[model samples]
Each structure stands twice: as structure tokens, then as C-alpha cells.
Target chain A: MTQKTLRKGNEALAEGAIRAGARFFAGYPITPQNEVPEYMAAHMADNGGAFVQAESEVAAINMVYGAAATGTRSMTSSSSPGISLKQEGITYLASADLPCLIVNVMRGGPGLGSISGAQGDYFQATRGGGNGDYHIIVLAPNSVEELGNFPKLGFDLAEKYRMPCMILADGILGQMMESMAFNFDPVDPNKIGKFDWAVDIHKNGRKKSKVFSYKGDNLIADVTERAKRYGLIEKTEARYEARNCEGADVILVAYGLSSRACLEAVSKAEEKGLKVGLFRPITLWPFPSKALKEVSQKAKGILVVEQSLGQLVQDVKLAVGDSVPVGLNAYPAGGQPDGEQILTAAKSLLTGKKEGLFDLQTHAEGFTYECKRDLSLGVQGDRKEVK
Target chain B: MSTILAKKPSTLTDLPMHYCPGCGHGIVHRLLAETFEELNIADRVIGVAPVGCAVFADDYFTCDTVQGAHGRGPAIATGVKRSKPGAIVFSYQGDGDLASIGMAEIVHAAVRSENITVIFINNAIYGMTGGQMAPTTLVGQVATTAPKGRDPKMQGWPINMCEMLSQITGSKYLARVAVDTPQNVLKAKACIKKAFENQVNNVGFSMVEVISQCPTNWHASVEQALEFVRTKMIPQYPLGVFKDEGAK
Candidate 1:
């Protein structure tokens, strides 16, 4: 492992993709994720690769579909609204079981959300944004180092399952700098397994292959098989990092940047004579629920701290069950709560003096910058305001 | 006496196509198949099927095929061609998939001058979606969306992709051909062959837009549909190569 001087999560992801043999990148320049395509534009030529700043997110993902069908390692990166445009193509990518990487440096949204950091796309990322009964392997990184390794793992899993894999990160992760070591196993194009169903011209007496999503008549049956695959993934791919849970009274569950804040909050609470622990999910989709279920038994309560309005909190309640009380420090839209607020919440929870049960709260004043882009509601259905 | 329909062209299979009766798509498919065969690059050709009438084109083409999102055939084809430099890539698209939803894809693909082929079938109206108005719908054409007849003020002027694409320097072989008659079918085949040859030689973006008859959408007899392509559609969408390899 060669230690590189400090690199941002976006840069680390780019370097990791290159080391893992990503040769094709298609994306429109969106905030936070601009570095990914920028890096590819400069370096792709030298590596005999391709980089295209597509006209729209829709075009970019279709380009990914094309490249992946040819059995090449390809990727695309964007922020929230842009990722929304890509859901259609991503869904098709999932249906085709094409292996590619999609990096989403999430920002605020139900629509054209801000460009600033927010974990609002948590449900979209982990649940497979596209309309399908399928799921992408969603990996969330709490640190820059994990960002570097997670992409390699994403590609490996994508190839392993013959599906698209997403590195679900946030704007903060994309921008923050940290010292990280770059480690990757070289992928030989020859060693990579070719799906005979992929669309590649056969040259050496090989059978012809076709790649398509028209699994007609039996669409439901096909979707059911995809769900079963997700079941297996849920059973074995749960990943999380536990700290100070030996005899904890409260387990603070968080992911991405919020998880980092929760970690600090745990330490701060320990200093205040409160027994709290941190449960950070690295794989947000195959959500380390089993581990959380086991940990929930020993704890008095579980506080779900996330940057979204009670999204992952529901998952926590489902896993931990009604045996323990669950509290939510929910932040809606672009409001990213900080360590100070989280520490206060942790302290209150330990002392049985916590404020409100599942309070639907917005981010406390003045911790984040609003994105300049229009944060219009982009949901397909009618928007009802959450009070 | 045994009569064969030209051995099903080397690039296409003998399996009966799923196209409606008298649909010009089958003719265009045959022409493309023959073109690939003539170039002796059938095995090295990869085709992208679009979401409209020709969505099941993969089943027709003996070559490797991939289905793209509606109108995304060109972008997908670009990916295949660029990835496998030695291979020939083409997208078979209908009016809805090519002129409307996928407009950005084909236009951008041409602007980028990707070394690929795009076979655009224009029949004036959207045939697969219950005769809806397409971007290529004529000035007075009537479709489900344009019940009052396509008004230039309400519905924009029909998009002539050949003329539009010809302006892009990236396009090397751009042509608007018709497949309404046997004579036109032969001409269309030649045009498609040249486009494929351009890709084999790494000559930039090439396209063959075939003015086809949509009997079902036009609500005309099979013979009348052919007449419409020859009389009305051709006068508006004239047959000729708009851009040649020399320009690129």
C-alpha cells in the first residue's frame, strides 16, 4: 500500500477507479462530483480510456449502459438532481445486470436540491432509485480512505452479482481532504468474466450474445428472482463498524458524514459519564441490520441520527423491534446537524431526559451552505408538506 | 419452383419478424442486414434496438444486439463502437425513439463524431404509441396528440435530422434515403453499406435516415402508405447524402 499525501474523497475515488481499471466515464458536471469527471478527462487519454460530459444525466447513464454492455469497466458521477435524471437508465442497468460503478455525492432534495452536503438521497441510493424490484449494492464511506477502498469493492461486487454498484457518498465526503493509502488489485480484461448475454461482437467462433431489458410476460417473475438475490445479499453482505458497545446503554446509529459526528458525540458523551456507542453502517443497502438487531438487545434505547427526515430511523426500529425505545434526531432537506447538537442529544438520551420522541426536526440554524441551484420538488407524485 | 427472399441477408436471421403487416421497418431491417453482409463485417457488427416499433430488432439481427432506453440507441451504439474499435455499431430507431425522446442522444452522438452508424426510420407519426404526433410529424399531419392537424404555431416544424446533422462537422456520412419502393430499397441499402464501411475504416459518425411508410399510423392502405412516402414524405424529406466522408 502506497500512502499518498492528503486527497479528497472524490480524488481518492478517481484514483481507486483508475487502479481498478475503470476506462469509461460519462457525466454532466455537477457540484461536488465535478472532480471525478475532471480527473477522468485529463487522465483517460493516457490510459486509452473514454470520457464524455454528456448533455444530460439521462444521456450519461445510457452511455454507461452502452459501455457496460460491451463488457468494459465504466462509471459516472453526479450530485442529487443529476442522479435523479439517471434513475431511468440505472434501473435498466440493474435489469440488464450490467456491472458498472455510479458515484453519487448526495446533496439536498426531493427535487433540484442544493449543491451543499446532505444525506437526503439515502433512501434513493440504498433502495435502488429506479422503479424496479431490484437493488444496487450501495456502499457508504464515512472517511476518505473508505471512499478509496469502497469503489474497488463496488466493482468487485458488481461483477460478482452482475449488477450496477453505487458508492453512495455526500458532498462533504467528496470535498473533504484526508491522508489516504491507495490499494487495488489489477483487473485483467481477459480474466474478467464475459456475460454471453452482453452485446459484444463475437470474433473467434464464439456464440453471439444479446443484452436487453425486455423480459416480457414474465416481468413479475423476473423481478421476483431479483428480489431473491437481494434477500441473499441482505443475509450475507451486512457491514458495519461497532465501537464501545461492550456494555452500552444507547447505540447511536448513523451513516456517511453524520456517522462521523455521531462518533465524536459518543466520545463527548463518554467524557460526560454517559455510556453510549456508535453503529456505523458501511454498506447502507445490505444494511447491517442483523448486527443492529443483536446490539439492540443489550442497549436501553437506540437513537437514529441521520441527515434525512426519519428515513433510516424506520429501518432501525424494524431491526431493533419494540423491545427498545428508538429516538430520532431527524434532519430534513439540507439541514446537516453537527457534532455539538448530536453530543447534546446523546447526553440527554443517556440521562433519560431526551427531548421529544421522533421529533420531525429541520437542521438547526447556520451549520451548512444552501446550494445555488433550484431546490424545487422533483418527486414524481404530488408533494405534501411534512409538518 | 423454389423462390428464396435473398437468403435472409447474411446479417439477419430467417426467423419471421414481429413487425405489423406492410410495416416499412422490415424492409429497412433487411436493407441494413444486407449492407452488413456486403461489407463482410456481419460478425463484427453490434446493433442497438430502440424502444419503439423496432424494439425487438435484436431478434432480427444475427449480430450481437443491445436494447437501449427509448431514443437512447445512438448513445448506446457510440459506447459499443468506441469500446470495440474494430467493431461496427449501429442503432435502429423509429420516429418516437429517434426524433422525440432520444433527440439529444442522436444529435450529441453526431456532434461528437462518434465512429458509429445510426439507422433512423422516419414515418412521420409515432406508430407504436397509438399514432401520436412525433417530432417528424408534417405540417398538416393528424395524430392522436395533434388532433387538430399539426399546426406550425402550436406544434413546431418537423425536424429534418439529416439537414440538422449535416451541419455538424463530426458527421462523416449522413444521408436521407427512402424504402418505399424496390428502387428506393436498393438505394437505401447502398447508403447503409457505405455508412458501415465508414465505421470499418474509422471514418467518424455516419447515419442513414430511411423515409418509411407507417400504414397503421397513417391509417392508409399498404399501397397508399408507399405512395405517401414517395409523394408527400419524400418531397419534404428528399433522398440524398447530406454529408459525405470528405467533409469529415
Candidate 2:
């Protein structure tokens, strides 16, 4: 039976890796996610497993790449600045299609911005951080429970797709304690079969093999095939969670801790007689655009709430097209958006008013005072038409 | 017969070696392959080769082998050892790969007490990439990068690997040996065997730094390389067991 225990996101990640049959961990410590390496060191020490506190993040990532090449389950964890140092190895792993798990407990940063919880790395995690026409399956967990469960899923997806999978979380989710289930099914490595290319000992009559990332065939054909594979993955694996989306007039799109806050706001807005909902994406790379489009059909607007400057909002806008208005509830670096504030914005949109919502692209679009007055007059004339 | 010239044992198949004639790497490779044969651990041994002179080591050693990027052998070996706890994993690294680029990898792997063996070959220069001076090159040693002889004021001192590695508690066995003479080759073989045995017994990190000769890079004859090893390398990196608690 699955049992629950008090655990933080980092501990859950450690347990999940163990459950997924990860036998090796090589990482250097970084704040907010140091517990992962520490736990692996202690646990692997007693089990005759391997754990190495590499001298730097660069060394740790290359180590993971090497281990993964041998068809073994291995992992590493770090925060923003440290993760940046690992881009070189990550690109190589992606090019090789090596299977491994990487956990990033994000803190504020363009460059050492802050140690506090921040969702500032959404683009880097989703897009190309390293140099390559490749993508990693990025899983963003919204709760302590998901933090525990996603590592196993990440490992399975890594092996299944032959690609790296990331558990993109923030410092708060990593450090906060909550009760969670710890039991997991045992992994049978043969289920995935021994990688024929793995550099393992061969007995008599076995032919030598190679495991490299070089794509040396017809250049265009090789890149074209890789692109086709990525397209297939995009079609099949993109996943997200939605709540109260049925017949809702307004949707809130967010990820990680911000999604949790958006869920609370959506519930409060519902109590105050506004049709509100939430869309929390699980896989950020194979983004849940289809699901967002389906939700947008019934919604009048989408409020993209996030801890960063609403990076995902652009994605939502792209998904929904111009069929519905896409709003923003941005909470810049230091402050967090309150549920009351979100509720008020929902009320304004429900009543056909659009005066005080945050418009991240307003000045960039060159909206002057004259434009606002003209828009307000138009809205008044539309009200007269309704009367 | 010494382990150095023991007829290429079953552990190391006679698959025409790809190394150049008079290359000391061949001697070091034979010593390790024969050690695996002597210990009867060939079936369960895994070798990690770096991107240097020993890149094709798998063609020589009969055991399972994987290649790592430059300076990443130790980390890869640590991962292999961790995942396959019942198997023996060792990284065969050269002076440039181990002492220079991979310095951080080897150091931290030893510090963590990873239960893997490392056979570090210090030839005082980078042989594969055309004889650049290595971090282990002695103060007065000359190489392509150190044309004026390694200047102590400009370049750093020759790294004493055995002495430095002995500081790590994670290492159960650490030693520096050489292959200049018949007697010294024997001692070096014994040290390598012990390091491998330590891993078999799960005794933690083990390493043997072999002070080797590089005739091509050092601009000397095969006999002269041996002579240089004895007259120059040995005095700097003495042939002895620096640290060993393996039998305990």
C-alpha cells in the first residue's frame, strides 16, 4: 500500500530517483536544491551505490552524460546559476539522446538575481538553453505530491523517448514540507531492454559497438529525421491540468507555485459569481497548446498569472489566437499577486470593464492616452447597442 | 616472467595494438589488462577510456569498455560503479586528461570515496594532442607548450599526484609507481593489482599514478626514454606505495 509522510519537494525527488532505479548521482551543491545531492550521498553510501559531489556543475553534468551513455539510470540537481553552467553538457546529452534526469530548483535570476522563490527560468527550461536543434521534456510540478511522483515519470519518459527530462521547480516547492506517499513499484530494467549501443562488457562472439552523438549520415536527412521525431513527440506527449474549465468565461494560466495561487484565486472568483478556471501545464516543452485552445472556446478571456513577468502569457496568447482576450496578472520579482486582486480583475472582465489590468505589452505597442479614450468610447457605444 | 611481458593473457586478447611502437602507453595498458587476467575478474570488469592516447583501449582490453570525453573518465567510472555495484569499474587516464582538464573530476570522485579504481598515467606531457606540457611536467621538463623548459615562476610546480591524492580519506589505496626498469615495472604491477583488488572488495577509491616515459614528446630514443624515466621522473615521483590499506 502507498503510505504518506511529511516530505519536501527535494526529498520526494530523491525518493523518486531511487524508485526509478537511479543508481548513480553526480552533482555539486547549490542553494535551495543542495538536499538532493546530500540525500543521495547518504543513501547511496549505505547501499553500495555511487554518489559523487563533483568539484563543479560542469563536471557533474558531463558525468551524468557518461553514465547515461552506458544505459544506466543517473541524475543531477542544481539551481539557476549552476544549471546555466551545465548548458554545454546538456546540449551534448540532447544531441546524443542520452537518458537522464535533471532537477532545477529555481531561484530569481537573469544573473544571481536572488535566492527567493522565482519562476524566472520558464523560457530557458522550455526552449534551447544549450546549442542544438533539440528539446528536453520539461515537467513543471505544481505541488509537493507531483514533486514526489514526477521523477519516476521523468525517468520513464527519458528512457522511452531517449531524451533528457527536467523537473523544473522553484525554491519554495523544493524547500517546503508536506505529507506525501513514498511507495513505488520496482523497476525491471529488461522492460526497456539493454541498450545495444551501451558500453558494457561483451562476452565471446559479441560484436563491438559505438555510442556517440555524431549524426554523420546525409546531413539534411539526419536533421530532417530528428525534426520529425520531435514533431511526433510534440503531438503525443504534451500534458497539462485544467480545473473548472467547463463553460467558464475566464481562464487563469500558470505553472509551479503560481498555479497553486491561481487555483485559490479561481475558487474565490467562483464564490463571487464569476466563471473562472485554471490551466496548469505539466510538460512545458511539448506544451499543452491543444488543451488551451479547447478551453479558450468557452472562455471569454485568459488571465496569465505568474511569479515572473508573465512569460507564459505570450504562449497562451499564441495558443488562443485573437479569438479571446488574453490578460496578465504579473507579479514581478519581489511581490506576489493576492487572490483578492485576481478576484477584482475577474469581476471587471465579467462586467465588461477593462480599466486596471496589467498590460505587459502596452507601452511597447505604443498605446497613447488618445487610444485609451477612443477604446473607452467604443466600449460605451457597445454598451448602448446592448441596451 | 614479469607481468610486463607476460604473454598477452586471455584477459587482453592479441588484437594487434593500435598504439605506436615505443609508446609507454602500451606497457601501461598491458600491465592493467594482465592484472585483470591475474585477478580472474575479467568477466565483471568495466573500463572507462578517455579521449587521449588510450582512446582505443577497448580494442586491447577484453573487458567491457566505454569512452568518456576529455577529463571526464573518473565521473563516468563513478556512475558505472554506482549502477553496477557488483562489477569492477576503472578509468584509464593520461597526464593531460587526468591531471589538467579532469583535475576536478578525479579530485571530487576520490573525495566522495567512490568505490572505483583509477590508473593515472603521468608521462609529463600531452602525447595525443602533439606533446603539450602537462600539469605533471617537472620544473625543467620541456614540451611543445613549454619550449623553454617548464618555468617554475611562470608555470606551476610539478603536481605530486600520489602525495596529493593521499590526502583524500575517500581513497583506500593511492600510490605512485614507474616502468623505467625491470624491478620498478614489477613494483608498478603490484601497485596496480592492489588498486584493482581494493575495488573488488568494496574498499572505496583506489588509484595508482604511473610515472611513465614519452619518447616521442621528450625527443629521446626508447632506451633513452627509459633512462630519462630513471634519472629524471623517478627522483621527482619516487617508485613506492604512497598509501595502501587494501588488505585490511
Candidate 3:
């Protein structure tokens, strides 16, 4: 357990979950996150688990619903498009108060956008993508080590709160290989205590358990009671990593993969004698608002950097409202920003320059796309001349 | 004659069901509970209820139950069975629930040879949603959607689930039964029992499609609905065991 071996982000998270006592996994194939299910199919049986190659993403998540209802530690993994397909089951699990883990190795999208890594699903993950007033625990891990570590933490949080938990990594984080090891020893389901509410086998005069989401008459009471749990989670579970925000004039706020870029940018800012700090939220749902609010007090400018077009900035703006001048540097829809690009944005925030800002208005003025396709392929010629 | 004739199965709960008068669902529910009790697997039985009129089917069973989204019973049942292989899981579904919106799930569940039982009630109309045309509606059946009495050229044919599922290699057992007469009801019970028995014996993917009558949806009296099943519905959906791959 102490040894660290090189592993892909997707594969490491899969093994991490197996160690965390995820005894069931059901998922349909999708880009970037295929390794998670593939790894599960190979190793889950060896560790006393079930792996289902479901017909579709819809079927896969419902399988997770079924397994979780029976008090088994269940999970499913998918990319952006597949995750969208799982919203129905996710909302059902949330409504029924079933605990399970969902991993979204994100790709570009509005439709089947691209297979490249993007943080376009920030709103989807943090803002309850399903049709309900519910919040799932969202853990945004930045590195391979965090990816390997978050599944155990995610599973524990999901069970403790009796809600769905998500590990929101992107295509880059999933496919890129790095050295990381699981932090916890492998868990045994036999040693675990059974949940009283689980709809498993009935035995010896015990009242049979019923797991259903249709509260009909008590729908109001059920949802309202669950809202109290969400409120408690919001207050206590907000997590983030702060770096050098003591006396900075500019601070960069980001999460997941984008945070890694901001971390390097912070050091570059200090070397250039530019006062800059970084606040990376690990729990995107809870948003680390209070901590960011405290960190923003000493700063004059807050630069929100993200892979999506100004999505994370909205949360940052809400967290640090009216106190600081907020700016956005969005590298949206498969756009991966490097440390230099973030540092340039940081430098512009310190000065009165608009060069580094990539907001909708600024970026919109830079390009005028023409709707034209190359029509050269339609020309007919002799077979020899065609070459 | 004073001796106990037919008490309800112990697996059935005391909770009252919200079914329509003369509905076939009541009969099917009784047969399932009896199957669980007779097989001595009631303690390990888990029922997945669908989202039609029988959405509250879980409440009627003393066994552990789960109610999921409409047409997702098979996927959920597959999950429950795979997680606890020793547990006997069944998905109770309606015609519209199994054949229409949930076609992909039911078909794939069979294709995977999953060890589960499906109690399919084909009443030819969507009863809970107020008599809409279902995927199993007869060619000339009058429904809210098929007001012109279901033009075959436009609405297509009623899907024969047993006949269709019988061709699939993974489908181990398939039967179409009815609850029209006393004799047919007993026959239907035998088929329902066989479907559950298949799961208990680890025989993969068994389903018993009951050709039921919906007096409310059919706009007929209970007697007329029963007569219609014998005269009209059964001729199209016919009764008898279609396939049985026992113990395999």
C-alpha cells in the first residue's frame, strides 16, 4: 500500500474504488473514461465484485440504482455525453436517498462536442444536473494522486450522507499517466455493517425493507427533510487548497485540472514580484465560498480561470461579491490553458490591461467565423486524372 | 367444505391495493405471492415494481421491494439479482411499460440471459394514463390515441412479446397465458409459477406474458371485458407455453 506505481488517471481511480469497497460497477463505453469500466471488468471479479457492461448509459446508472438499493457499494463511470444520459437514474438515486459513486471523466460538449478534455460540465456537476432540488457530493481532484485518493473519500462521504458522490475529472486527467498509489487498504464487504434501509434479503420476523422514490403524499415532507441534509453538507463539507493569499493584489480561483495550471501560475507570479494567490476548490458543489470570501478580503482583484467559458467564475463572483473587482479568463470547450496563459492573465489583472481577459465579449470581438465548407471534393474526373 | 379453501399467500402484505374492479393485476399478484411462498424463497425475494397502475405493486408484497422509473424495472432487477445472486428478483411490468418505452431494456435483459423473472401484463391499452394505445393494442382496438380503431396501415401491428422473445438465444423460458376463465386463470398461475421457478433454479431470463383485460380502459363491463379477452384479445395474443429451457 505504501508503494507508488505509474498509472493512468482512469485506471488508478478504478483500482482506488475497488479498494474502497465498490462491489458493483455498471457502465456503457464512452471516450476517455473507458479505462474505468475496462479496468473494472478485468479486476472487479477477482476482488468479489460485479461488473456489468450495460446496453446504454441509461441502463448502466439504473443498474447502479438497483445494486445500491440492495446495500451494495455500487458505482458507474462515464464521460460527458454518457453522464447526461445518466441524469434520470442519478435524480432517482438522489430522491430515494441511495448512496453510490458516479465518476464523470469529462469531454467537450453541448452535443457530442469533442473527445478532448474540457470543464464544460462545471454547471452540470455542481448545480444538480437532474430535475430536483438536491445536491450530490462533488469532489474535483486535480492530479493522479488526488484521483487515486478521492474515490475512498468520495465513497465514505456518499455513505455517510446517504447521497450520490461524483469525482469530476476531465479527459486529460483520465488519459494521462502518472505515478500514484491508493491510500487505504482494500475494504472487505463482509466486515461492513448492513444498512437497515437497504432492500436486500428478508429474514426471521424482520420487517422487509422497501426502497422507493415515490413519496406521493409525503413528497413535500420528504424533499424538505432532505434539504436539511444538503444544508448541513454545504456548511461543513466545503473543501479547498489555498496557496499564498496573505498579501496578494490578485488571486486566481479554479478547480480540478485548471487548478494545476493556476498553482504553477502562482509561483511564477511571486517570482515576477507580482502579488498573486491561488484558491482551488476541491468540492465544487459546496464551492468553498466562505474560505474564498476570507481569502478575497486582502486581495484587490480576483481572476477566475477555468476550462469552461466563465462557469467557475460565476461561483467565485458569488463568493466574493462587491468586495473585489472580479475578472474572467475562460479557456472554454476543449481549450486547455497553460501556466503562461494564466500568468499573463494574472499580470493583466494587476495592471489595467485587458489583453489577458478572455470573457465572451472580449473573445467574441477577436474572431468572425464564416459558414463555408470546402467544395473541392465534388469535382468528377477520369480515374487516372483524379489522382 | 368448512376447511380452509384459499387464504391469501403469507408473502402478500395486509396493505390494500389500489387496483380497478375485475382487474387481472390482482390475480397476477396473488399468483406471484403464492409462487414465492410455495418455493420457500419469500425471504430472499425482491420485487421491482414498474411505473404504471402497478407502481404501488411493491407495497402489496411483504418481500423487500424497489420502485424505479417507468420501464426501468428490468435494469433494476438485473442489478439486484447480480448484486445478490442468491436472492430471487422479479420485475412486474405492464404492456406499455415492457413493450413500448422499455422495449430496449426488456430485450437486452433477455439477450444477456440474466437470471430474473418478468411478470408481463398485456392489457392492450395504457390503463393508468387513461386508455391510450399501447404497443400491444390489437389492430382494430379503439384507444384514446387510436380513435379510428387503430388503422393497421398507420399504427402497425401489436407486438407478440412471447413469440418475439422466443427467438432470442438467451431467453430460457417464454410463455403467454390469460386470466379470462377459471380454467385459464389456473393455467396462467401455473405459467407464472414456472417463470419464478426458473429464476430460483438459476434458469436464465424467464417471462410469463399474461393477456389480461382492462374493463375500465376497454370501456366495457367486467363480463364484457372477460368475453372480449376470449373472443378478440386471445386470438391475436394466444395462450400456451412458447419455449422452456429448463435448468439450463
Per-prediction tally of clashes: 1, 1, 0
* Residue-level lDDT tens digits of model 1 in A282-370: 88888888899887788877887887767888778778777877777656576666666765665555665534223322233323322
Higher-scoring candidate on DockQ, 2 or 3? 3
Candidate 1 second chain TM: 0.95
Model 1, residue B113: distance off in Å is 0.2
DockQ of each: 0.75, 0.30, 0.83
The deviation in Å at residue B173 for candidate 3 is 0.5
Once fitted onto the true fold, the runs of candidate 1 whose alpha carbons sit more than 4 angstroms away are: A350-387, B1-5, B246-248
Q: Which prediction has the highest TM-score against the true structure?
A: 3
Task: For candidate 3, write residues A1-387 as lDDT tens digits.
Answer: 649899999998998999889999999999989999999999999998999999999999999999999989999999999999999999999999999999999999889999999899999999889997888899999999889889889988998999999999978999999988777888887776899999877778778898898889999999999999989998999999988888988888988888888888887887888888889899998889999999889898888888876788889878888898887777776877677777777776677565556433333355432212211211111212111
Q: Which regions of candidate 3 deviate over 4 angstroms?
A: A359-387
Q: What CAPRI-style quality would you assign to candidate 1?
A: medium
- For candidate 1, give the DockQ: 0.75
Fraction of the native A-B contacts that model 3 recovers: 0.80
Scored by DockQ, the top model is 3
The models' CA-based lDDT, in order, is 0.82, 0.79, 0.88
Per-candidate fnat, comma-separated: 0.69, 0.44, 0.80
